[model samples]
Target chain A: MSTRLPTFGNVGLAETLQNRRLLAGIVVFVVLALYPAMTLNAYHTRLLTWIMCFAIAAMGFNIVLGYTGLLSFGHAAFFGTGMYTVVLVMGRVGITDLVAVMVIAMVVSGLVGAIIGVLTVKTHEIYFALLTLALAQLLYILAVRDIGGLTRGTDGIGVTRPDFFGIPISELPAQIYLLGFYYHVVLVALAATIVLLWFVLRSPFGLTLKMIRENETRAEMTGVPVLRYRVYSMILSAMVVGLGGALYAVLIGHITPEYLDWTMSGEIVFMALLGGIGTFFGPVVGAGGFILLQELALSYTEYWHFTMGLVLFIVVLTLRENGIWGGAKTLVERLNDRRGEQ
Target chain B: MSSEPILKTENVRKDFGSIVAVDGVSVEFYDDEIVGIIGPNGAGKTTFTNLISGALPLTDGTIIFDGEDISGLQKYKRVRRGLVRSFQIPQIYDEMTVFENMQASVLSRKQENNRLFTPTHRDSASVSETERLLELFNLEAHADDHTEHLPHGVRKVLDVAMSFALEPEIMILDEPTSGVGSREKNAVMETITEAAVEQQIGLIFIEHDMELIRDYSDRIVALHEGRVLADDDVAAVMNSEEVNQFILEGGV
Candidate 1:
C-alpha cells in the first residue's frame, strides 16, 4: 500500500490561483480595467474592450460548466438573448439605462431558459448537449425570420446606449469608459457569483449536484432530487449567459443573429474547457487567453481558426494524459515540498 | 423501546414500467437496532434503500420519519433530517482529504444557513467535531491526504466516516464490505462495528456474507425475489428451512 498522503482539507481559492485558473482571470480583468490607463491608443483600448466583452460572456459559461458541470453548447443564445432584450427595452421604452437593461436581461434570459430548460433538463449526457444546441438554433431562426421587425431579422438591430441618468454616453471617452464600467460591474457580479457558487457547491444542494454528476443512482438512493437540481443549474446557467449577452451588446455597439449562433455557444464551452475547469476561474483565464490568442493569430492570418484548433487539440490531449490541472499542481507542490524540506 | 420510531416505510412500492422492484413493503425501523437487509440480487435491496432515502418516487406508500412524512422530500432535505447513506462502491470525494470531506458533511447538514449569502462557519464546534471523527476513524495521520489517493480500505472507511459527520439518526450502509480485499475486510468490519457501537445510530446494512451478517446484525430480514422470506434473530433467520433450502439450491 502507498504511504498515506497529507490532507489539504477543502481547497478552492488557493487551488484557484496557484493552479493559475483564476490567475489568468485576474490578469485578464486587471488588464481590461487598466486599458485606458495602460494604453493611449483608442483602437487598442477598443480591442481590449472587446476582449473584456468575450471574457464576461465566457465567465457566465464558466458558471454553468465550472460550477454546475453542465456543458451548454448554446450559451451564445443566452448571450444574444440578453443583448436583444436590452436593445428592445432601450428601443421600445426609450430606456437606455445599462443597469436596468442588465437586470431585465437576467429576468428575460431566465424566463427564456426556463421555457427551454423545462423541455431539456431530464435528458443527460449527449442528449442534453444536442437538445440545447437545437434550442439555441430554434431561437436563432425565430430571431432572424419571425421577429424580424423587433429583432431586425438576420440583418440584426442597431443596439443603442441611451443616456446614463441623462448623461449622453456616446459623446465622451470617460462616458464611454463609464459605459465600459459595466464590464467591471459585471466583473464584480461575476466574482460575487463565483463566491456564491463556491458556497452553493459546498451546500447540501450543491453536493447533490456533484453527487448526481458523479453517481446518479447512488445519489438518488441517497434521496437527491436530481431533476430539480438539474433544472436549477440550467436556469442559473441561462441567467449568467444572458447577463453576459447584455453586457456584451453594450461593448460591441450592436446586437446580431451571429451572437445567437452555434459558433458563439461553442466558443463559450471552448473557453471554459481551455481555462481548466478544475477551478472556478479556469474559464475566465481561458476566455482571456483564447481571445488574446485569437487577436494575435488574426493579426497574422485568416487561418487562425485552424491554428487555434490544433492548439486546443494538443492541450486537450496533453491534459487528458496528465489530468486536468493535476500535472501543474503536482509540479508546484513538489517544488513547495522541496523548498519546505530545505 | 423508545416512544419514537426513527424510520418507517409504509407499503412503499416502486415499479419501472411493469416490473415492481419493491412491492408494498412495510417496515418500522427503530432506534439502536442494526438491521441487516439480506436479499438475493433483484430482491429490491437498493430500490428499497432509495425509496426510504427519497431517491425514487413511491408508487403508493408513505415514508414517515419521526412522525414526518418524508415520502417525497428532496434528497438533500432527507439528508438534513438525518437520513444518510453510504454507497456500496464508496463515494468518497477524491479531490478532498478525509478531514475536508467530513467538514463538507458538517457544512452540508445545515445546508439552508450555509446557502444564504455567507457561510455559517461561526460554529467553531464543527471544526472540533471533525477532529473527533478523525480520531474515531483513525485517520488522523493522513488527515490532509486527498481521499482519492487513499488505499481502497481507507477510502471505504473514510466514506463511512463522512456519513457520520452529519450525526444522522439513521444510516443505510450499502454493502460496506463489497469489493474490499478479503485481507482488509476483517479490519474494515471491526471499524464499522466499532463506529456503530459508539454512535448508537440505527443502521440498515446490506451484506452478502452470511458469517459477517450473523456476527454483527441484531436481527436479519431476509428477502428472496423482492419479498420478505424471514425476519428474526440472526441465527434463527440463518437456520430457517427456507434459507437452508435456498442455499442448498445455490440461491444464497
Candidate 2:
C-alpha cells in the first residue's frame, strides 16, 4: 500500500482546524458553565438547563432519523419512559440519589427502545414511522389511564429535587443557594452528551449509519447487516433520548401524561429539523432555538403556537431545509471559500 | 482453471408470483476465470446473480459458496464470504465523496463497521486501502467530489471499485458498461478486467455488447428464457447456433 496520504491535500490544515474547533468547543462549554454565576436570574438559568435537556433528546433523535434514515414519530415513547422512570424510582422506590435515578431511567428507556426497535425496524418508510407512533401512543394511553395506578393517571405527580452527591438539593435553603450548582450539573451532562455523540458520529458505526441513510441496498451489499444495525441505532438513539428525558424530569420536577403524548414527540422532531437533522450540533442548536422561541412567543401572546408555527415555516423555507446550524455552516464555508480565493 | 468450483448454484430458481425469473438452472464458477453472462433484457441474468449474491432468495435451489451452503444467508453474509456484486445502475451514495464511499466498503470488509467510537477518518488501515482502490481505479482526481455530480461512467467505475474493495474472491458485474458512453466502455472494461486479473478475482459480468463479451470473457454463459442455452468457452458459445439465433441475432 502507498504510504502517502490520499491526494485530497490540506491534511495538515484540516488537522489544525480540527484542533481549533475542539479548543473553541471547550471555550464555549466554559462560558456556558460560568453563565449561571454571571446571571442572577435563576429562571434564565433554568430555561437554559431545559434547553440542554431537549438538546440531549434531539441529539438522540438525530442518531436514528437523521443518521440512520429512519423517521420515527414516536420517540416520545423513550423520552416519556425516561421521565416516568425517574419519577417512579424516586417516588415508589424512594431513591433519593439523582445519579441512580438517571441511570435507572436510561436503562428502562433503553429496554423500551430495544423492544420497539424489534417490533418496528422490519417495517420500512411510512410503515416504520406509523408503527413507532402506534407504539408510543400505546404508552401514552397506558400513562393516561394510569394502569394499576402506577402513572397516577392524567393528574400526574410532582417530584422533589433529589440529592446530588449528598448535596441536599431538596431542601429550600440549599435549593436557592445551590441553584447554580444544579445548572452546572446540567451543563456538565450536556457537555458530556455532546462529547459522546461527537465521538459516535465520527466513528465507524456512525459512518455505517450514514451509509444506511444514503443507500440501504448498497450498504447491505457491502457486508452491513442492515436490519441488525437499524435495531442497534434504535437502541442507542433511545438511550440518549432517555437520558435527555431523565434530565428534563429533574429540571421540571413534575411528570404528566402530556410528556408521553405524540405532541412531545413532534416537538423533538421539530427541534432536530430546526437545527439541521443530520449535522453535528444541529439538534442542540434546534433545541436551544426552539425553547427560546417558545419562551419568547409565550410571553407575548396566548396564540404562541400560531406564532411559533409561522416562524418555523419561514425558517424552514429560508434555510432551505438545512436547519439553522446547517445554514450557518454553509455561510461559514462560503466565507472561507472567498477568503481562500482572496 | 481450478479443479474445485469456488461458487456453485444447484437448480437455483426465482419466481415472482407465477412468473419464473430464473428457472432451475445450475452453474459452477471456478476461481481465476472471467465468465460473461449474456442474455436479452428480460432474461434471468440479473435475477440469477441476485440469487447468488443473496440479494434475492432462491425459490427452489441452493447456492454453495466456498464449499458452504449459503442458501439461507443474508446478503451481507454472502458479501462477508467474498461473494460481492455491483449493481446494474451503479448504486452509490450521492451525498458522500468518492473516498468516503470506498472507505465504507473497506470498513465493512475489515469488520470494523461496528467500531462505535473510533472515527472512520482515523482508521489508518481502511483509509490506506480506500486510497489504494481509488488509485487503482484512477479515481484519485475525483476522490473528494460528491458522487451526485460524477459522470455516469465514473459512477459505474466507483460501484465496481467498491465491490473490489471488499477483496472478493468472486465479483459479479451486472451490465457494468450499461449507461456508459460508447467511447468510455472499453476503458471501463479494461480497468475492471485488469484489476480483477491483478487481484485474482473471478469475474462474472452481464453484458449486451457482443464484442466486449468476446474480448473479455474466458467463458460465456448464454441464457434465454431463464435457461442456460450454452455454457462453454467464449469462442464455442459465441459460435454456437442457439446463442447466435436466440441471443445475438433475434434476442438483441
- Who wins the TM-score comparison? 2
lDDT of 2 by residue, A1-342 (tens): 333334434568667557878779978998888777787778888888899999999999999988998999999999999999988898899997989888898889889999999999789889998999999999999999989889889989887778887877677475463466677777888888898989898889988999999999999999999989999999899999999999888778779999889999999999988898858889999999999999999999999999878878887888845789999989999999999999
Residue pairs in steric clash, candidate 2?
Answer: none
List the per-model TM-score of the A chain.
0.83, 0.92
TM-score of each: 0.83, 0.95
Best by DockQ: 2
Q: Which stretches of candidate 1 lie over 4 Å from their true place?
A: A1-32, A173-212, A216-224, A320-342, B3-5, B8-27, B39-44, B54-80, B113-125, B248-251
lDDT of 1 by residue, A258-330 (tens): 8888998888877767767665556656777688888889999899999788777876777742333444666
CAPRI grade of model 2: medium
TM-score of candidate 1 versus the correct structure, residues matched by position: 0.83
Candidate 1 Cα deviation (angstroms), residue A122:
1.8
- For model 1, residues B1-252, the per-residue Cα lDDT tens digits are 566789988777889999988888887787688889887788898988978876688888899998899887877778878888888887866655666666656655645322433332333455567677888889888888987778888878887887877677889999998888988787887887777778877888998887788888988887766667787888898888996665425555
